[model samples]
Target: MIDKKQWQAEQAQFNDTSRYNDIMDKPRHVSHAHLPMTGRDRAGQFAPFAALTGYHELLNKIAQRYVNKKYPTGAEEQAIFDFFHQLPTGDAVRLELTYFNGESGYYEHYRGTLDHVNWAQQVAYFADGPQIPLRNIRVVNRKGNAHGQG
Candidate 1:
């Protein structure tokens, strides 16, 4: 490698602008062939974008890998109904609700406090804001209860 003095001398020579005296103060050339791009248009070229167009579809497919809606058996359904009826309306009850999601064809587990049940709509309202259909429920577990019915 060159010594420090030799590198400094080379850098000094490179920094000299006397050689470009003719064009040092000249204006920047403007292109006549193409119109100027707006700031928004110029930024669009380097802006963030989704390279994989169908990436969301791929994720959905992966999520549905094990999807096959499971229905409760006759005895299990009876147990689920019996458990649901026992819960007092407008009472705070921590529960683990296992219900089938028709769109994804998979069982979904929601753990939260039961707010109330809308009997006319056949939906169970939870404090955390999920209104699940009674028919879709496959399993229900009341928190602190060792035995859960499915």
Candidate 2:
């Protein structure tokens, strides 16, 4: 290992800020009016560029897996219909809903209180503000009740 004094002395030359200080103190030849770029424009010139355009978006799309809407079987349909018929008036019953989200083109499962069941429109409105079509529903689970119990 080199001696501490010798090592510090060698480093002292590189640590000198005199050259940089002199360059900064020197007046620039270009006038403010003649300057081609503003601060924002100058910063944008050094901004990072995407090597592969849309690569991140493509990766995100691939990473995001979605489930397709599942059609209910005959027995499941019957049970769901029965559960809806037995619901007490104005009562908020907890329900697990599996329905299609058109915006995402995926089937998402949600658990919330059933606010209204529109038989004529064939839609079930949840308390959390999702109006799910009866045909789009894959599964219906009544909270705190077993299958065919509620």
Candidate 3:
């Protein structure tokens, strides 16, 4: 603990504007003719530099979750193929589809009514709007029916 009078004296000295003004009023002597930098240019000098380019991107890629493409068994493949053939034409069929998302590089499951099935293109179009490739599909379930059923 400091004495109250001494503390007040110290505070008075620190708060003295004349002392601060005296230091700030001193002329700055520069050896060479150099133009003063703008605030933006001055900030650029202290801006953070990336030592290793793409390091953050590489780390983000490593941290991102990815689902490996699943290869169905012979029986499972046949079942999926059969379901595509049996689909009622022009009828909205509710389906649970698990397919690879190319953009995310991950497998995503979606439950929605299928708008169309393009046998030629081997893609299933969802009512909510998403065309999933049949080759990337891992699982399928018809609405009101159990898994593996059309």
Q: What is the TM-score of each candidate against the true structure?
A: 0.48, 0.46, 0.49
Q: Name the Cα RMSD for model 2.
A: 15.8
Candidate 3, residues 1-150, lDDT tens digits: the string is 357999999999887787577679778876578877789988787666645667777766655534455567777777777877888888778888777786677788889888887889988888788999876677787765543422
lDDT (tens digit, per residue) of candidate 1 on 45-77: 865564566777777777675367565567776
User: Could you report the Cα RMSD, in angstroms, for every candidate shown?
Assistant: 16.9, 15.8, 15.6
Which portions of model 2 show Cα errors greater than 4 Å? 1-67, 146-150
Question: What range of 10 consecutive residues in model 2 has the weakest lDDT sum?
Answer: 141-150
Choose 1 or 3, whichever is better by lDDT. 1
Best by TM-score: 3
Best candidate (score: lDDT)? 1
Report every candidate's CA lDDT.
0.76, 0.73, 0.75
What tens-digit string does per-residue lDDT give for candidate 2 at 1-150?
Answer: 357998899889788787798588777687677757789888787666645667777666654533454556788777777778888978778887666675576877788888898999988998889888776666667665644221
Q: Rank the candidates by TM-score, best first.
A: 3, 1, 2
The candidate with the higher TM-score, 1 or 2, is 1
Query: Which candidate model has the greater lDDT, 1 or 2?
Result: 1
The segments of candidate 3 whose C-alpha lies over 4 angstroms from its true place after superposition are 1-67, 147-150
Q: Which pairs in model 3 have colliding backbones?
A: none
